[model samples]
Target: MADPIDPSGLGRLLSETMSALGQFGGGPQDDVVPPEGVGEAADGMVRAAVAPPGRVTALALDPRVMRMASESLAEEITRAVNGALADLQEKAAGAVPGQVDLGGLGDQLRRIQEDAGRQLTKFTDSLIEAQDRLARQGGK
Candidate 1:
């Protein structure tokens, strides 16, 4: 039989790739996030915000087994979801002005919303599955 595939390399590659992507998006996040209840904060700023619609594609990941790969797969799915959501926000914003007619607008909006909802549900489910897989791997 052929030699077993080395999962360590795959895991390392994935982890590095994830780190690069995260840095590319919004730099690294602060290690500690401030509590929300502290009243006024700073001005609005953009950061890599993972969106919901990409939950499945982001999460539909399976890589050779290594602890690093497991973590990377999870992170990628999360990042992908955020990226998907960002795109949706842009689309929504752009379409808002074009949808002037309230009735027609409502119909169009409803369709879009329903489609997004379906997709989001699918992605979320996939993410959950991925997480379960990760948990199982960890248990082993």
Candidate 2:
């Protein structure tokens, strides 16, 4: 006997298909302005703000950090700036409107499409074999 087809699975795929269709209804859109990302280092002695377009908009260096050598200060500044820019990338990825999260929805869609294709191919092969069997029996 064949395995039963789950209606819920089909329903979920249909829902996802509809969602994708609706999301793509409009043409290309403008980029959304992302929120600023701020990061601190050296126990908050150095703080950096990464504004939109990934530019460092502001920097706050505490007077305490001023006593450090130039090389050490440069390293601390690099650390703080890197942290802020990393945060900016994360916020920008999540801030886009109607963007499908590849982590979840994209995986589900890929699985569903693969399963559907396999099932369709299986169905077609079975039909062909059945037709061949019928033809053979009729000839006999």
Candidate 3:
């Protein structure tokens, strides 16, 4: 009988490789359910519900807010929305399980690439220097 393919093993290997390359984390995180964010303004007279990805899923405005000037209402709404989006971002960052922090990884990867380029440049320069010396000796 032919050996069965171990798809899970292959998936794990790929996931590990991507993670090592500072790409993403592995495994399903549905269990770590994300929490919704709420932003309130004017003593909760205006509220915004923000879901994942900074989406405003809903907005609630108290009837009292209607009595305020139009400009004031607009400002309150804007403030609520901004607060909700910021809250959502924080929640989303904390929601994922086994999530890799890319903040430092990006800088680390850039430094590695820069170091590699410098080494390559040095190697090329050495090779050229050797060749030039050899050419001068051969001419003599």
TM-score, predicted candidate 3 vs. hidden true structure? 0.50
Candidates arranged by TM-score, highest first: 3, 2, 1
Mind giving the per-residue lDDT tens digits that candidate 3 earns over 31-95?
65667888999999999988876678999999999999999999999999999888888887776
Error of 3 at 113 (Å): 25
- After TM-score superposition, the amount by which residue 67's alpha carbon in candidate 1 deviates from its true location, in angstroms, is 95
Residue pairs with colliding backbones in model 2 are none
lDDT tens digits, residues 1-140, model 1? 22333435445545655554444344454763421111111111112233333233222322332334556545554454555566656754553323235565456546655655555566567677779889999999
Judged by lDDT relative to the true structure, which candidate is superior, 1 or 2?
A: 2
User: Where in model 1 is the C-alpha error above 4 Å?
Assistant: 1-100
TM per candidate: 0.28, 0.48, 0.50
Residue 45 of candidate 1: its Cα lDDT? 15
Query: TM-score winner among the candidates?
Result: 3
Better of 1 and 3 by lDDT: 3
